[model samples]
Target chain A: MDFFFEGYLLSHGNVIGFIAGTLTTISFLPQVYYVYRSKKTTDISLSMYLLFFFGVLTWLVYGLILGSPPIIFFNAITLLLSGAVLLAKLIY
Target chain B: MDFFFEGYLLSHGNVIGFIAGTLTTISFLPQVYYVYRSKKTTDISLSMYLLFFFGVLTWLVYGLILGSPPIIFFNAITLLLSGAVLLAKLIY
Candidate 1:
């Protein structure tokens, strides 16, 4: 808790959870960045993104139910990140 | 219990976990297939796949520690799938 005294407060477990969750959640960014940079998405699969977004959405719900801030926060961000990729796959 | 009596056995919670896990794990296949089909990997990020593989590996270890069948099963598959993608990104 003191680690957050400067600004934020999170349990050690939550901090660990956030670390793991951040790693997984942000992993999607590179793909999105690739697409954004290349402007080519035909090689990417729409079905994959669709299924992935669905799964992430479910995780967000599960996190809410579980009252896990790390899970909820990371999944929410992932949802948006995945949604952007899915949109790119559609638009480009 | 009855669900598995015919051939397999898994609790309802496990069943649900498996369903969600399957959706996320199998989602990696499409990208792998795309890379396999197109053989174009310049746009994809090596860092992203590297990070992803690491994250999945952690999940796998966590699953093994928890003795959660669905987590173990899915993370193992995801490791392979993500590994395949990472390999493809490297190879092609």
Candidate 2:
């Protein structure tokens, strides 16, 4: 089972990772949209999201240094998504 | 500069990574609390968070298989935080 899973991930890992990362990262869309629609970020914490955004940036650098494709790829998407949410929170 | 950056990451990478990862992962707390307090996840997308949650799980597995400490640690924390948000979204 492990072997099969590994093989599946290895062959399709990049594609899956990309899709998953894209979808998950963009998941913030609904929240951002609602926040925009409502013009409220009352519940969102600025400091936390800022820190998290920076952390994601650092991780992206880490991935670049380590030459890890998935890390780099996922972090890139996550950064964008997280950043968008943070921006929306700040704006609204 | 690059060397210094690499060395910094090498020496304090794990620690910084942990802190960043923890902070970022837990940043969801405010959102969750807000959603809970307001009793609304109207802006939140269940499918997106669910998929992202699963994606995080898969990445955790990928990190484990790759034996990457940062990946493992960060993903572990992220899983918990994202999971919490997902649960809160579902419950409230």
Candidate 3:
């Protein structure tokens, strides 16, 4: 039953989650681009991104433990986005 | 079994998820404060938060339908955070 449910979700939940996750992940791009273009991150908080990165990292681990690809994949992308924001905050 | 699992999770996952969720949610506060403090959202993207909000809203709905408290709770808080960011982008 567990295996069956996992397989079912892999085909359905994984696809749906990925689609939703991709949209959510790309949504941060504009902010990243804005900061990159402007070279100003004063209004952005460094701690926020730093903390967010860790939180997403934890979620990634959680997803992995649960064998949930969507959670893992989404968090990985989110980690990158948050990491970029943190880097921009530092550089700009 | 489902009820037991839900109850078990309500005591465990809910608490952990809420802790993680609160941390993630508050992480956005700093950004919000910075935006409010500077009143300069020139670097912030309205579309990012708008899209994020909808993505999270979808997640919230997904969680509710699945009867997953963690997803619903975290997304709810996230919705507020992202909403604030969008509002700040518009106002500032």
Supply every candidate's count of residue pairs whose N, Cα or C atoms clash at under 3 angstroms: 1, 0, 0
What is the per-residue lDDT of model 2 for residues A1-92, given as tens digits with 9 covering 90 to 100?
Answer: 27757776666655655665666666666666666677776556676578778878877876766678876887787788778778887777
Scoring each candidate complex against the real one, what DockQ results?
A: 0.27, 0.43, 0.30
Candidate topping DockQ? 2
Question: Which pairs clash inside model 2?
Answer: none
Alpha-carbon shift of residue A12 in model 3 (angstroms): 7.3
Tell me the tens digit of each residue's lDDT in model 1 across B1-92. 13424233222334544556778888888888888888987767788889888887767655554556776788888899889888998887
Q: TM-score order of candidates, best first?
A: 3, 1, 2
- The 10 consecutive residues of candidate 2 chain A with the worst lDDT sum are A13-22
User: What's the lDDT for all of these models?
Assistant: 0.74, 0.71, 0.74
Please report the TM-score between candidate 2 and the true structure.
Answer: 0.72
Candidate 3's interface RMSD, please? Answer: 3.9
Clashing pairs for predicted structure model 3, backbone only: none
Model 3, range B1-92, lDDT digits (tens) per residue? 25546555444643444555667777888877788788887777788888888888777756754667777777888888878888988886
